[model samples]
Target: MRLFHFSEECSIERFVPRVKANRTNMPPVVWAIDEEHEFTFFFPRKCPRIVYTRSEGLTEADNHLFFGLTSCNIVITVETGWYDRIKKVSIYRYELPAESFQLFDETAGYYISTETITPLSVQTLTNPLDLLMARDIEVRFTSNLHPLREAILQSSLTDFGIHQFNQASAQ
Candidate 1:
């Protein structure tokens, strides 16, 4: 599967082959990113998606990889919303960093990073109703939460509902 890695220089469109043998079979697609790791872009696929996680080191799972190699614990969801008008929305950008050395057996001796929750509002297409028929308006921000996911999950129910919908559709 193809995954996007956001960086300052460029947004890497890496085509991680389903199999290790096909790694060298295809070239990757790279897009330029601004100084800030932020940009308004769309994947070639539908919204409410999960990209493969990033990892370092070796493991039986990593060694015997397939097209859908799960590594990082991150999931990004994109959905459409409506308020005064339709809004193209994306949210729930969560990153679960490796918590224990066992997670990355090869890098066990080194210090592992804690999970980070990055709440991102990638882009909002205004007046999206003209483009699509959907209407909803919900926004809130709160503190007292250690991670951003808690804040996000508490702020809006619409987003959470949409996330569930996406997951159901995928299955």
Candidate 2:
């Protein structure tokens, strides 16, 4: 399966999870469902440094299991798939117009999960409604001012375009 990541800069040859400004001490990696989601379009995703495959077609029960094993954030689209691959994944970058990024409702709640191990990951995202049906999974959505949203609003340039990605072999 092919995973995608986007960035404003073109220097990203490798997809490495980055430390958010609030949590610089940790070394977790993250990615989004696709460019369609608002959060993924606004932020960056990275593959870990381990050997694992992508987790796609997750059911509500599967989400509980996955969330229990590792920390993940929100779920936006039901079709979104996140991989646990960590073998230095290569990236193929494409240009995305800034207008492609459509923001979701900020007033709605969002999920936030985190893991501290080799498959270090963070799932900061918009609510994927299907994942909320699981009783065991606590889907705590946030309506606060997130860092990414702040960055988007504060930027002076409006003609910005994001660098979207695909696997190296596919390109």
Candidate 3:
């Protein structure tokens, strides 16, 4: 399967193993998302979002509560405040060979490699919202993401990703 690394910076030539500022205790590595889960990363790097999909054995009640009337298999919710930034930013998708990566998180489709990697190609996603629409994923904007974030944390919706939740707006 193909793996991808998404970033706002476009001039990246190669990715070197380095410790994430937030997780210095973890070993230095290159991180990439498998194609199956890359859609969640199609936004400004720090935009707070909740991406979820219906998993096996999901109850009808939970489905209706979490997804409502959406027919799309996946839904991404974000705080309304990030909309302007999301529209202004250009996201780059770096396609990397999957040889050296190991599965880090199955649900998140995260893979890690200790070796440095050079991207096979980089794609510029000019319109992130259109990308989501073309993928048939529902994008929901809410004034506050706290309520949904809290509910999803306590939810049976096990297949979910909460990206940069701390950066979300207070209201």
Candidate 4:
């Protein structure tokens, strides 16, 4: 199982365990993504996005509503404002050793380690939007992600991640 950590910073020699904003009550831990859901981080950090897949239990109606005519199994939606940034910014994909990490969220493909560690290797992704296109992942840009967020929250699309909601546009 390959584990990865994505960041905008190029030279991160060491990864220290730090408490995430949402995980404040828990102990500090280093987070990494498994191979399956690595696409979720294929953008600038905090670039509000809604990444989802058509999982087994997804209802046809809900799938039609959310996915529409897209043939891609996965869809990543962000706002128009982040388009330039997505096209220009470089993301560093750090390959981390998985020996010390344990699964944190299976669905989200997140693994957590309580100890600090060094990356096995690092690769820079120059064009994030292009990577999505190359992988046959549909990228949707809108004026705001609120509507999509509301729909997914009430829909049967349980296999989804709405990241950095507060960072999304109001309108």
Question: In candidate 3, which residue ranges exceed 4 Å CA deviation?
Answer: none
Give the top-scoring candidate (TM-score): 4
Task: Write down the TM-score of every candidate.
Answer: 0.19, 0.22, 0.95, 0.97
* Model 3, position 13: C-alpha lDDT score: 97
What is the TM-score (0 to 1) of candidate 3? 0.95
**Residue 61: error of model 1 in Å?**
2.0
lDDT against the true structure, per candidate, is 0.25, 0.30, 0.92, 0.92
- Per residue, candidate 4 scores C-alpha lDDT tens digits across 1-171 of 999999999999989999999878989999999988898999889899999988887898998998899899899999999999999999999999999999999999999999999999999989888888898999999998999888898888879998998899886
The number of the candidate with the highest lDDT is 4
lDDT of 3 by residue, 109-166 (tens): 9999999999999999888999899999999999999999888877788889888987
Residue 167's lDDT within candidate 3 is 91
Q: Per-residue lDDT tens digits of candidate 1, residues 5-107? A: 2222222222121322323452332222222111122221122322222234434443343113433232233332222221433222122122221211121
Candidate 2, residue 31: the lDDT equals 38
Task: Put down candidate 2 lDDT per residue, 50-156, tens digits, no spaces.
Answer: 11111454455544532445444432211112221211222333322222232222222111223211221223333223223342222222222133233323443
Our model 1 lands, by Cα RMSD against the true structure, at 18.6
| Sort order, lDDT high to low | 4, 3, 2, 1
**Model 2 RMSD, rounded to 1 decimal:** 18.5
lDDT, candidate 1, residue 49? 23
Would you list the rank order by TM-score, best first? 4, 3, 2, 1
lDDT of 3: 0.92
